[model samples]
Target: MSQSVAARPRSLWRDRNFLTMWSGQALSQFGEQITGLAIPVLAVLLLHATEFEVGLLNAAGVAAFLVVGLPAGAWIDRMRKRHVMIWADAVRAVALATVPVLWWLGWLDIWHLIAVALVFGIATVFFDVSYQSIVPSLVPAAQIPEANGKLESTQQLAGIAGPAIGGWLIGILTAPLAVLATVGTYIASFIALCLTRDTEVVAPRDEHEPLLRSIGEGLRWVFGNRYLRRIVGTTGVSNLFSTISFTMLPIFILRDLGLSPEAMGVIFSLGAIGGLLGAMATPHIVRWIGEGRAIPVSAIGFSVIGLFLPVAALAPAVAFPLLVAQSFVASFTVLLYNIVQVSFRQRITPKRLLGRMNASVRFCVWGVMPLAALAAGGLGAWLGVVPTMWIGAIGGLVSAAFVVFGPFWAMRELPAALEEADADASR
Candidate 1:
């Protein structure tokens, strides 16, 4: 009997529900990568946007994360997560489709682009918060890391291929038409989501309770927990600094380094290979470091690597390669952090509180991304791009100090509650 059990193939292949969600996620991520290329290319090429304007666009996206995160979490808790995902996909499809239409009408402008980015970003927050909350309900706790690893791996593959495709498509059809491809990808994802079959999530029974009260409870529950508070604080500080660094990177590349669009695309694609390697290696990393120790260390590692970007300008020939190295290290470190953090959160969070908790986390962490972008752009405008990048790097170093010095650094094993849950699932 033991031999027979051991002989069974370890794969998510037999799980039809996970398969459906994974396939849809793969397609959605591909579309997202294309847009990540399309948006900046469109701004720089078509609208002749200034550095500040480009930063504004990025800020617009994160602004959505800030504004809608908590409410969306509450809203998600009130409906089936799958339904929320389908609706979010449908909304994104419509938002992306508008780009091609407006471009054809000679009505394309930065405002239109920013609007699309913001709305699509909001929908994405809803989809992501719900998706993260629902995954634990769909799979046993032991499979959580495997599922997240596969998802991260798919994201890396998309990062590699999607930008290459987007770059080529832009070269052939121009930026506006390149966006249409993303629209189609979203439609495919929407259909796939609609096809997903799983046990429906029941909305929590709280009809007499006010929405604000429920939202407040979620906020309290997430922030009230000792473990959750530490995770949020660590992630929020890390993200803020990283955002500042990222916001300045494009400016430093274009204005200071004088790299071309095609060159930047290649650099991004090459950097994506780092994420692929990171994803492939996460399971092993978790085992080696132990999941608890992995999170804070990886978070610190990611922050440390951010300092390398500003140092790239010293040698033009080696600058791009150094930047690529930064990308690789950043991808690896961030993925390691994510796999552990997401799995830990999934294990600890109750099903009823999942949506609100996930959203609240995003609200706090990514909420500052846009502000950081704006500050980087403004500071770069005042101090010059190189100086701004130096400041950003310094900020990154400071960010790491918080998590490394905190109590989180000593977490060398799974929490007691989570270990018990994992044991239960393995049975």
Candidate 2:
């Protein structure tokens, strides 16, 4: 264990196996960040896709969470999660690398880009399910929040740097070739995954049983639990509303505001700095405010404050600042919310059901996000960009009410007392 990890007793970072896992995850996140920009640029610049087509590309990615998430989760529950993650990363690297290769061969096209997107999306579903499921075995319950916080921080840092780098590469090398940088990140991720060692853990036995029954059991556990239920509901609604605005932000900036691609990259990267700060601070905030209250408070604030993005139309000079501010608040709030939710789920779920449980909830929460994106795009085409944004902002505020009206708002703290209660219940 490293000295920093050792300083924090009972922390996951102190565990050698989890340290390896976190390092691998962090490395992979860098590549994941580049893809968010590179892939879209490929579609828009190289393939000459339309606005609806761009929306379709995003929708296709989210399709995996809907179509394959449940079954993939169940399948992963029967396998070695670490290996699953490694293979997933490897597949993604190869798929992303194909873009550059095909471009060189003069074979790059919109359909090919879409195919790669779908494949990458499927791989992500598998990796995410495995990663979430395996966290419990990597650390003690007390360390889950800290582990989640650290992971969130790493992801935020990737968000901060990846787009800027991608934009720079695109400016110099073109969009297709810039994807090679993303591929390099995936390669690094794969290498890190190879170095990681995991302590042996048991797989779920329910895979051999009726598939529907097994899936149902996992769903029941997540939804039946009061805490998880509230989390799923709150996040799902918030995600739906947030997706509306997020889906159109790029279009608004690049098309409506006439910002250069480089400027868009800089804006995203700068805003991500706030995300990094938020993720770094999340553990402290949780400790101070308690997980229960802190988590929902951030969610509400993120959604409500998101409304201010449209105010940027008042002046183009302030547009970047407004966008950055929205990104800052939303990223911070979402990261904090994820920290609490992921840690709680890992702590409460049994190892046997972790994969399915993680997937089931994610499916419910994120499956609708793509459709929301499509709706945003269609609306943006029909109504103007500003009007579409207005709709999104209103929807986001209303979605925050899910948390406000729920029992999540009533729980002002999470402490050793709740831990003891969980211990007693588990026994």
Candidate 3:
């Protein structure tokens, strides 16, 4: 263990390749957050879209996970991840830039926005699958937790600035011009990716293998493993309910509460600080409580905090603080859950299977988001926003039971290696 520890890279900050990749991803994540706010606000304000339309728009943006997620993993496994990422970024940049250009031409419409969201989401699916697959090669296995923590921290930090700035931009420049910021960020991300170099060679694969067979291999590997199966259940259920709540959050905050765009931005920004804190604390928490234990605890904690969202509807004065508190605590626990889970997935999976494994996991986790958004939208349209949120929050709280009752909760510690875990399982 000592020798293994000694062989690991001590500091990610000192590595130029990692830094370049991290910088590009940081900018890209921040850009995504900006668009996240700007797009929905644009739909509501400029297009005068109904709650169901807004939900549909959000669903369209993430629908690619269900569309191309499986094949993307198989295809990416056969190519250089860095090159795939670079092209993905370039494509997304061009796609997003069209939005602002069309708006400036006074030809922007809901269909145009929908087209852009779908195209951008397709690029994002490739980028995300490649990104997760490449990280383990960039750092040693022992350092994965630290690396993931740092990456999560960067994401949280971007979440802090992105929405707040997006909100302010939307307030001053309106939603159309606000999207231009993401265009610049994507361009910057492209440049950052261009500067980095990947030292690892692409993993070898059979040239004649059928694509369907390759995809099936990934699916079998993920579902065949007990640990991953439980993770899928936990993540899928939680994401389903979380998306339901968030799908209508814009209407609740901006329309129902009558909050200004800037104020709404501030609320989200302040809430993201909890995520940053969680990232900073993860390594210590893992050491203290063990990784296996942390998962259920975080999941349950997040659910408990989520209960506050529906309660926040009592009054405007009561709503602001309670909503902020809910966001803060929920973000914190979610980050903690994600950091450990992602690290564990990376650590356990072999290099040749990383892309497929990540993709399969995402397929289960994110594919449900669009469905949940549509459900929430339909419910919000029929039952009203607050009632929809109530169902979402309660459903999310209950989903934690999947983890609490699963194999993960029974283990005191995660196995040190996948082979050892497999051996124990077989015995």
Q: List the residue pairs that clash in candidate 2.
A: none
Best by lDDT: 3
Q: lDDT of all predictions, in order shown?
A: 0.80, 0.77, 0.86
Return the lDDT, model 2, position 174.
89
For 1-427, candidate 1 gives per-residue lDDT tens digits of 6998986646787888788888888998998888888888788768977778877888988888788888888888888898899999999999989999999999999999989989988988988998888777667767877888888889999988887788788788898998888888888888888888756567647562577876887788677666667778778877776777777666667556887656676777888998898888878887787767777788778888987888897777899899888888888888888878887777776777788888889999889888888887787667877777777777777665545666565666766485554343344
* TM-score, structure 2 vs. true: 0.91
Q: How accurate is candidate 3 locally (lDDT)?
A: 0.86
Q: Following a full C-alpha superposition, what root-mean-square deviation does model 3 have from the true structure?
A: 2.1
Error at 345, model 1, angstroms: 0.4
Per-model clash counts, in order, read 0, 0, 0
Which scores higher on lDDT, 2 or 3? Answer: 3
For model 2, the stretches where C-alpha displacement exceeds 4 angstroms are 1-16, 204-207, 415-427
TM-score winner between 1 and 3, please give it: 3
Per-candidate RMSD, Å: 3.5, 3.5, 2.1
Error of 3 at 216 (Å): 1.6
